[model samples]
Every structure is written in C-alpha cells, then in structure tokens.
Target: MSGNRLYLSVSLLLSVGYFWLGWSLMQPEPKHNFTPCLFKNVTGIACPSCGTTRSVLLITKGHLQEAALTNPLGLLAAIIMLTLPAWLLYDFFRREKTFYNNYSIAERFINKNKKIIIPITVSLMLGNWIWNICKGL
Candidate 1:
C-alpha cells in the first residue's frame, strides 16, 4: 500500500487497540487465563511478547518501572502507540507525508544494513524471550 494509506490504517488500528485496552481495564479481571498468545497456549512457554499487554497497561497507568520490568518492548510500543496517531493525523490534515518519508528512509536504511541489523534484531528478541522465560511471564 501507499505510505499515506498505510499510515492511516496503522493509526486507526492502533487507536482501536488502545481503546480496547482501556475498555478491558475498566472491567473486572477474568477468573481464568485468557491470554491471546497461541504460541504460549500450545507450548506452555512465555514468548518474547508474553508480558507486553501487562507492560503496556502498566505504562498507561504511569508505572514506568513496572512496565519496563514487565517487558522493555512495551515502552517502545507505548511510545509508538501514543505518539504515532497524533503525528499521522497532523500529517494527514496538512496534506504532508513527513512520517511516511521518514518511514521510507528508515526502511531503506534497515534494508541496506540488513546484514548488521537482522542479527542484532534477532539477538534482542532472543534476549527478550530468555528474560520472559526467566521471569515466569
């Protein structure tokens, strides 16, 4: 898809996700485990993203330390979820494509540096998975 459409679609999806998160928080916690992770369900092992939801919830509640302890990726996710929509909307209203342009630049950089970037990304994910397992997430 084109950059504008991609941005708009992502922004809307993220907004809806945030709204669902908020709504879930308002309800009472479920009695049984209702995790959304199929990998975890089948394997009985915490995936790299196991605690991300709890981490993001803690982040929304302003518990930065807890959120980080839960999952460092949540901090990154929170930053993107919180800021991206506003930036996308701003660009959309102004008929600008700065975010898309930057995204393209980043994509090109990552593609060019894949030999370096891919290994690092994989290592980080593996590290996170190890951390999650150790923490019994």
Candidate 2:
C-alpha cells in the first residue's frame, strides 16, 4: 500500500539523517566569537533565532542563567533539537506496517488542540524572552 511505502521511505530517510547528524556532532564545531543574525542588516534587532548557539553552549557548560540570558527560547529550542531526532527515529520505526496501528490518546492530542495551542506557544515564548531580558537587568 501507499501508506506502507511512505512509512518505509520516511524510516529510511530518518535513519540516514540520524546517522549524518551524529557524525557531524561528533566532529569539532567551529569557534566564532561574533554572533550571526540575519536581522543584523535589516531590522537591527536580533531575530527570535539569534543567540541560539550561545544559549546551547551555555546550557552545555551548565550555565543556566547565561543560557537563559542569551536566549530562553533558544535553550528550549536546543532541547527540542536534541530530542527531535530520537523522536523521529522512534516514530519512523513504529510507523512501519501498522506497527503502532492504534495510536494512543497522547498522539491524538496533536489534532485536538492546534487552534489554541499554537497561539499559546507563541505567547509563552514571547513571555519567556521578555522575562529573560527583564531578569538580565
């Protein structure tokens, strides 16, 4: 069936992607003191994605306050980035041939709350950023 092929394809792609990502992470990352932000030339305000790497680095160094100062959202983003690949792999593996044919209630939550959830997530991130900036002062 088409669904089965789709599942298999996704699994294969995720497997390859996970392999590449692990390989890349094992290698040494670049050292750049200057921060990079696309909005630097435009609005001059650091975009929402700015300071992401600094936040990640700070988090890894166990500097929670510094990580949050750099970007609270970025720290959360880093957590998601770290877990997403594993989640994708899990999902990919389970999707095959109806391996997880009966989806759980938790999985059903995704389709049930999109309208309210999205705006709430945006508001929470914005609030977190504002709180972080205020806390820095």
Candidate 3:
C-alpha cells in the first residue's frame, strides 16, 4: 500500500479499536482487559502508559480530572486518536498532503530541538512512571 493508504488504514484500525474499547467499557462488567501492558506484566510495576486506556475512557465520558489522574499521556493520545483520523480523511478526500506535510514539519522541529525536547520528554515520562507507580495503577 502507498504511504498515505497505510497511514489511513492504521488510523482507521485505531478508531475501531477505540470504539471496541468504548463498547466493552459500557458492559455491566467487562470480562476482558482490552489493553494489557507488557511492561507491567513482566515487571510488576506500572509503566508510564499503564493507565492510558482507562484515562482515555474517562476522557470520552467527560471526566477530565479523573482522566488526568489516570494518566496524562492519555489526554495526548485521545487528542491524536480524535484528530488524526479526521485530518487524514480530509487530506485523502481533498487529494492534499497536509497531514504528511505537518508530520514532516513536526519531525524537523523535533530534530532541531532534540537536545531540549528529548530531555524534557524523558523527564516527563519518568515523572509519569513514578506517578503511575505511586497510584498503584
């Protein structure tokens, strides 16, 4: 598949996964964990993203504070999950490469600021991991 098609396919799949998660969450009692963190399973400690799924679900239910407490990364993930697919669809329908262009711009910006961005990102992730551990997620 072409790069654009690949991007679209992945985005659509993620959207479907989110829908499934929502459906599962609506059940009186969910029998399965849709998202299992491998790191947590192996290490017996919550990973930085361990609670992201719950966080995203809370966000969908309009519980912003609860979502934040679950995992701040979920807020970023939810934003991407909601916006990326729509942006990709718009680009596909309009025969535009706006998404790709923006992705390239972001890549360049990150590369240009890696020295600063990398440290900040690592620090944030470490902090989040500590938070997850303390929360017993």
- Which runs of model 3 end up more than 4 angstroms from their true locations? 1-6, 9-13, 30-35
The residue-by-residue lDDT of candidate 3 on 1-137, one tens digit each, is 45667676778788786786677587675566444678877878888988887888888899999999999998998897888878888888999888877777888999999999999999999999999999888
Backbone clashes (count) for model 1: 0
Estimate the TM-score of every prediction. Answer: 0.91, 0.52, 0.83
Q: Which regions of candidate 1 deviate over 4 angstroms?
A: none
Give one clash count per candidate, in the order shown: 0, 0, 0
Cα error, candidate 1, residue 31 (Å)? 3.8
Regarding TM-score, does 2 or 3 come out ahead?
3
Model 3: which ten-residue window has the lowest total lDDT? 27-36
Deviation (Å) of 11 in candidate 3: 2.2
| Model 2 per-residue lDDT tens digits across residues 23-86 | 5446576674343455644655455555655676667678999888777765675676666556
Query: Quick one: best TM-score, which candidate?
Result: 1
For each candidate, the alpha-carbon lDDT, in order, equals 0.88, 0.60, 0.84
After superposition of all CA atoms, the RMSD between model 2 and the true structure is: 5.8
**By TM-score, how accurate is candidate 1?**
0.91
